[model samples]
Target chain A: MNTTVHEYRTGWKRALIETKISLTTPGDLMGFVMPTAIAIVVLLFMQGAEFEGAPVSLGAMNMPSLIGMNIVFGGITAMVGALAMDRTTGTLLRAKSMPGGMTGYLVGHLVSTAMFIAVTVIALLAVGLPLFDGLEFGTPDRWLMFLAVLVTGIVAALPIGAVLGALLDNPRNMGLVVFPIMGLVAVSGIFYPITALPGWLQAVGQVFPVYWMGLGMRHALLPDAAAAVEVGGSWRTATMFAVLALWAVASMALAPRLLRRMSRRESGSAVAARRADMQRDW
Target chain B: MGHPRPHDGPAIAVADLRMRYGDKDVLTGLDLEIEPGGVTALLGPNGAGKTTTIEILEGFRGRSGGRVSVLGVDPAHGDERWRARLGVVLQEWRDNGKWKVRDIVAHFAEYYKPYTDPWNADDLLDLVGLTAQGGQRVRTLSGGQRRRLDVALGIIGRPALLFLDEPTTGFDPHARREFHELIHRLTDLDGTTILLTTHDLDEAEKLAERILILAGGRIIADGSPDQLARAASTTAEVKWIQDGRLQIHATEDATDFVRKLLATDDGAVTDLEVHRASLEDAYLELVAQFEAGEAAAAVDTFQEATR
Candidate 1:
C-alpha cells in the first residue's frame, strides 16, 4: 500500500480503540450493549415453535441468523450514529486536512464497529447457550453453518450502514432512517421466522434483505431443519449473497464520493461564514 | 519605529496572489512579504477578506490566481514536511469536549513531525495559566480557557511559523495582556514567526511591529504603527490656557507655534498640550478616505455604464 493508505489505516485503528474505551455514560453503554443482548434473549425464548415442515425447538433453530440481526442493530446502527456526530461537529473536516486523513478516519470507524459487534455477539452467545436448554451445536456442520452466516451477515450490513451514514448529515435524521430498517430486520425472520407473520406482512418482509439474510443463515445453521421447510432452496443463499455483495460493493464505492462532496461543502469559507454569524449573534 | 533589521530571508512572500469567489474578487493581485521572527498584525473589519487571506496562507483554501509562497513552499501543494513547519490556530475549533486538557494536547502532538516533549505541553499549560486545570475535561473549561488551550496546542509543535486568527477576541484586559506576553515570548525565545488577524486596534498596536490595514478586499495601508499615525492627516491640535481661558488651535505648524509661545515668557501658555495623531485615529481616517474614494469610483462606473 502507499504511504497515505498505510498511515490512514494505522490512524484508523488507533481512533477505533480510542472510541471503544471512551464510553463513559450509562446511556451510551446501554445503547451499544442492549440490542445484542435482546436479540439473543428473544431468539432463545422462541425455540419451540411450529414451522410448515417440522416442529422446531431451540436445539434445531438457526442461531447465526439471530446473531446477524444483532450485529445489524448494535454494530451498523452505532457506526452511523457516531459518524453523523463527527460530521456535524467539524471533526471530519479536521480529519480531511490532516495527513492520511480520510483513509485513517474511515478505517477507525469500521474497526471500532467490527470490534463492538464481535464482543457483543460473543457475550450474548456465552449467556444464551446455557440459558436456552434446548439449543445445542455439537456437530461440525452446524459450526460451519454458523461461521458462514456470521461472515455473510456482517459483510451485508456494513455497506447499508455506510450509505445511511453518508446521506444523513444529522444524527437525528440518521436515527430516523436506522430505527425503521432495524425494526424490519428484528420483526422479520431475523429473530422469529417470517412464517409467523400475517400473509401480507410476510410478503412485505420478503422484499427486504434481512428476510433473505435470515433465510440464508437458517440454511447454514440448521441445514436439515431448514431442508424440511419449502423456503430452503439452492437459489436462496446464492441470490442473497449476490444481492448483498452488490450492495456492499456499491456502497463502499459510493461512500468516498459522498464523503468528498460533504468535505468540499465544509471548506474553509463555509466554516468562516458560520463563525462570523456566531460572532455577530454573540 | 525600529530600523529594518537584516534578515536571513523573508518568512512569507506572496507574489500576484489572486483569489476569486464566483465573479466577485476576494483578494485582488495581493502582494506581501513578512520578515521572520516577528508578529505581523493584519488589521481589517468584517467583509474585508481578512479571513480569506489568512485561510489561503494557512493552506486551508485554494487560491484562484497567484503564486503564493509560505515558509518557502506553495501552501496549495505543501506536503507533510511543510505542514510540520506550520502551526495554525483557526477561529473555528472542535474539541471532543469529553477529553481532558492534557489528553487533547497530547493527541495533537502525534500529528506533528518533531514536536517538543511531554514537558512542553505541561509547560504550555503553565504558561497559559491553566496548569492547575490540566486534568479537567475541556467541556468544563470556560470559553477563555478553551481559547488559551487552542493557542497552547497551536504552539505545542514548536512550529517555525504560526497563524493566529483573532486570538484574543473574548479575552478580558488582564488575560489579553498575559496572552500578548505569551506571543512575545514565542518570538523572543523560539524565533517563531507569527501572522495574526484582529479587529482589536489596541491588540495590533501592542503586539505587532508592522501593521497592514485592509479595506474592501485590498490593502489600504502598510507601515509601522508610528509611521501610520504620522502618514495619516498632517494636522495637529494645539491646546493651551491663555489668560485663564482655554484656547484651541488647529494647525499644521503646531510645533513652530508652540516654540514661539515658549520663546516668550508667556505664563498664559499654561497647560500646553499638543496632540499629533494616534494609530486608532490614523486607521479611522484611512478608512474614511478609502470609503470616499470607493464612492467616487462607484459613481463614475454608474455614469459610464448608463452612457
Candidate 2:
C-alpha cells in the first residue's frame, strides 16, 4: 500500500483504540453520560408545561432541541479539547517526528469525535423515546432526516472547533470557548423558541450553526404542527442546510491553514515549556 | 545486528548555524560535524543552545541562518524519507500517559513500516529492559523507566542516526549506569550514529567517542575523553606536611616540583599528595569563565593553554 494510505489506516486504528479507551475510562464515559442524564432530568421537570400557541408540551418541544444542542456541544467542544490537550502533552510533537504521522493524528481525532457524537445522539434518542410524547420517529423519512441533520451538524461544527483549538495556547482558557457556547445555546433556542428573543438576537442566533442545528433536529423529530413556534411557520429545511453548509465551507477553508501553523510551532522545547507552566499553575 | 550501510558523507554537518530568539541570539556562527557511526556528545551548561541546535538538526525548528545537513539532506527541506531515517529522543516526554507501553510502541512501529523494516515492538521493549512493564500504563512508570521507553521509541525505526537530548537528566545512579550500558549495546549492535547532549561531564566521557564542549553558543573544545582531560590538565596542585606544618603548592610541572621538594626536604616530607586537575574541574573552570562574561577569551585561553 502507499505510505499515505497506510498512515491513514493507522489513524483509523488509532481511532478505534482511543474510542475503546474512552469508553472504558470512567471519567471519559461519564463525560458522555452526565450531559444526557442532565438533559433527561431537565426534560422531565418541564413535563406538562405547555408552550404558548404551540400544540406540544414544553418537555416534548425540548427533547429535540436538547438533542440538537448536544450535537454542537459534542462536536465542537470535544474537538477543541482534544487538540489543546494533545498539543500540551507532546502528542503533536511525537506525530510530527514520524513520517505521515500528522495525517494519522488528525484522522484519528476526526474519527473519534464523530463516534462520540454518534454514541451520544443514540443514547439521548433511546432514553428520550420512552419518556417523551409527540416525538415523530415512526416513519422512515423522519429517521433519515434525523440522521442527515446529525451528520451535517457534526461536519459543520468540527472545523470551527479545530480553528478555535489551534488559536488557543492554553487548555485552562477553555472557559473562553465554554462561555460563548453557553451564550450561543441560550440565543439558539435550545430550551425555548428563538422568536421569543429580541429580533436582533434571533438574527444573531440564526447566523451561527447552533441555531440551525437545533432547528434541523426539531424539523426531523417534532410533530408537523410544532412548526407553529418557529420563526416563519415552516421547517426552512433548505435555508437550514444552506447556512450549515456555508459554515462548514468557511471553517474548513480556514482550519487547515491555522492548524498547520499551530502544528509547525510545536517542538520539544515548546512542550517542555508548557509542562513547566502547568507545574507552576498546579 | 544489522549491517552498516556504506555512506561516506558525515552523519551530521552544520556550518555557521545561527538562531535568534526575538532579540537575543541563542546560537551564533556555530559549526560542527559528526562522522558516521561515531558517538558524539554535546556538553554545555543550561541555555547554551544545545537543545536549539539539536532541534534544528531534527527539523523540528527552523534556524535564523546557516546550513545544516543530517543524513546528507538539509534538515529544513528534509522529506518524510529523511525523517524516517532519523530518531529523536527529546528531553522530556509525558505523552501517551493513558496508553499501555506495548500499545504505544506498537503504534509507533507502524509509522516506519512504509519507510523501513522496524524493530518488533515486543523485541524492542525487551531490548530496552521494559518487557515486564509492557502491560503497564506509561504514567505509572518511574522516571527512569519512562526514559528507557523513550529510547525504545527513538530507535524502533532502526534509524541511521539518533538524537538523545539529555537522556539521563533525572536518572538515579544505578539507572544512569544501566542506561549507559544500553547505549553501549546499541552502538555495538549496529553502527548507529548517536549524538547526545548533556551537562554531565562523566556521562559524556562514558558514552561518547568525541565530546564537543559548547559554551556561549560555540564549540569551545572538541576531542575524546582522554584528550580533553589532558588538554585541561595544564596545572597541578601538590599538598604535603613538613615538620608538623601543612604546605600546598600549585605548579605547571608537578613531577619536577615534587622531585625538588623531596630532594631538598631531607626525608622530612610526610603525608604528601598530588592531585591532577580532573576533567570535571576543567569543565567547571571553562563554564565559570564563560559565565563571567569572557566566553571568547576563555575559549581562546583554554585552546592555547591546552595546546
TM-score per candidate, chains pooled = 0.79, 0.95
What stretches of model 2 exceed 4 Å from their correct place?
Answer: B1-7, B239-249, B256-272, B288-307
lDDT of each: 0.67, 0.88
Top candidate, metric TM-score: 2
**Best candidate, DockQ:** 2
Residue-wise C-alpha lDDT for candidate 1, range B159-204, written one tens digit per residue: 7788988888777887777778878777775678999999777888
Look at candidate 2 and tell me the lDDT of residue A264: 85
As a whole number from 0 to 100, the lDDT of residue A202 in candidate 2 is 94
User: Which digits, one per residue and each the tens of the lDDT, describe model 2 over residues A1-282?
Assistant: 487889899999888878877877888989889877987898898987988988888898889988888888778888889888887888888889988888888888888888878887898898898798888899999999999999999898888899899998778778899899999999998899999999999999998989899999999999999999999998899999999999999999999999889888999999988878877998
Displacement of the residue B294 alpha carbon in candidate 2, Å: 6.2
Candidate 2 chain B minimal-lDDT segment of 10 residues: B1-10
Tell me what fraction of the real C-alpha contacts between chains A and B each candidate also makes: 0.19, 0.72
